[model samples]
Target: MIVITRYSVPEADSVAFQTDAATAVDVLSRRPGFRGHRIGRAADDPTLWTVVTEWDGAGYYRRALSDFDVKVQAVPLLSRAIDEPTAFEILAGGDL
Candidate 1:
């Protein structure tokens, strides 16, 4: 399973936004079934950032969100993510 969240942050808040994203990754990594995670800024648009996480399955991803620690440390950043579908299934991919 894949979860992708996009964030549009002002230049002034880029550092803070990346810090929050890192915190979110740290928290989520502790959850069961977490495969891997990555955070990146768009090459053409620096203000556009994304947090992408791979999980064993959709259930693991959902359960990670429900974790209390994740709620406290990650939810704030995640809540600021663009309002759109974030979860997806991999149709084809190599190890990431």
Candidate 2:
């Protein structure tokens, strides 16, 4: 599975940022190969918000990145909202 983690510092003035992110989450939830997503408010931390997502494979991930319009729409919203950027990982997980 592939994992992507997002730590966001949202724009001070735009409610649209959170709204858009939530919408994207809803859309992604309906897609094939989407495992799940988790979000949290960083603990007493002003500079962070956390998002984690799991996908079945690189192909599904790539399609989500390249083919989904909702995902594309998120770029500008994130740009306006985020301070740093999203982080990603291709994980190797199995029984040891």
Candidate 3:
């Protein structure tokens, strides 16, 4: 499973946002069902950032949300994500 969360950040807050995102990733990486993650800023829109995380499954992702560290260190940053569908199930893939 993959979760794609997009955030709209103002240029003035980019530094702080990146810092918090790094911390969020660090905290989440320590969680048991976390596969990996990637942080990205849109080439066309610098203010648009994304946090993509691969998880073992939806359950693992949900459980991670309930974790203490996640709630403290990550939830604040995650709460800024644009309201929309974020989680996805892999149905097909290919090497890039």
Candidate 4:
């Protein structure tokens, strides 16, 4: 499964957001069932960003969120994601 979290950051906060996002990714990477992740900025909108993470499954993703390190290092940044569904069940043919 994959999780896509988007955020709208002010131009002044870009650098800080990037640092915090990287820290979140690092903490998440140490958890079990983590697959990979990417941090991306939209070409058309510089203040728009997304954090995409792959996990072995939805369970793993949820469990990761409960970890103490993850709660401290990642949750804060993730909490700022746009108020929309973040997780998606990968389909047979391709992504959602």
lDDT of each: 0.95, 0.59, 0.95, 0.96
**TM-scores of the candidates in the order shown:** 0.96, 0.62, 0.96, 0.95
Better of 2 and 4 by TM-score: 4
After superposition, the stretches of candidate 4 with alpha carbons farther than 4 Å from their true spots are 93-96
Candidate 2: regions farther than 4 A off: 8-16, 77-96
For 4-85, candidate 1 gives per-residue lDDT tens digits of 9999999899999989999999999999999889899999999999999999999999999999999999999999999999
Clashes of 1: 0
Q: What order do candidates take by TM-score, descending? A: 3, 1, 4, 2
Where does candidate 4 clash, by residue pair?
none
Per-residue lDDT for 1-96 in model 4, tens only?
989999999989999999999999999999999999999999999999999999999999999999999999999999999999999988865454
Off by over 4 Å in 1: none
